[model samples]
Target: MPNVPAERRRVTLQRPGPLLIEGPVEVTSENGTTVSSDRFRVALCTCRRSSIYPWCDTSHRRRAGADDPRRAQPPPT
Candidate 1:
């Protein structure tokens, strides 16, 4: 998985709400700057209000059952 690109990386946002990013990732910006990390499995922010920037800080739980665009919508019954 080391040879794979970060952009190609994908994972599921489970019931617990953590971005389970899988491997060989090198987080970079448009400027080509590398954001170093200790591990390839990273939990990224989705609530858009994390004080920790990219990592989730349990903020999503505060808005449970609401129509959050970030969360996956229920399928049509």
Candidate 2:
């Protein structure tokens, strides 16, 4: 029997949002920190604003308006 190559993983780039990747993935940072995800799909954060760092916690979502309290606001001084 001929050896078969594994299927290429698929990735979806959502406009103004996270990059969805087929997972069971491991991510390593320059600081030597590593993170692993076993989800069927993982949303990696592109914008540097995720409170969860490399993961998308829906922080990239657009606000409906200035009055949208769901938007991230600065900590109270």
> For model 1, how does the per-residue alpha-carbon lDDT over 1-77 read when each residue is reduced to its tens digit?
34654476678686546676865455664577666456768776666566664666777677654755677777999
| TM-score: model 2 vs. ground truth | 0.67
Strongest candidate by lDDT: 2
Q: List pairs with backbone clashes in candidate 2.
A: none
lDDT (10s digit) by residue, model 2, range 1-77: 12445457799997567889997677776798889888989989887668997898877664334446666998999
Model 1 / residue 31 / CA error / Å: 7.6
The model with the greatest TM-score is: 2
> What TM-score would each prediction reach against the true structure?
0.48, 0.67
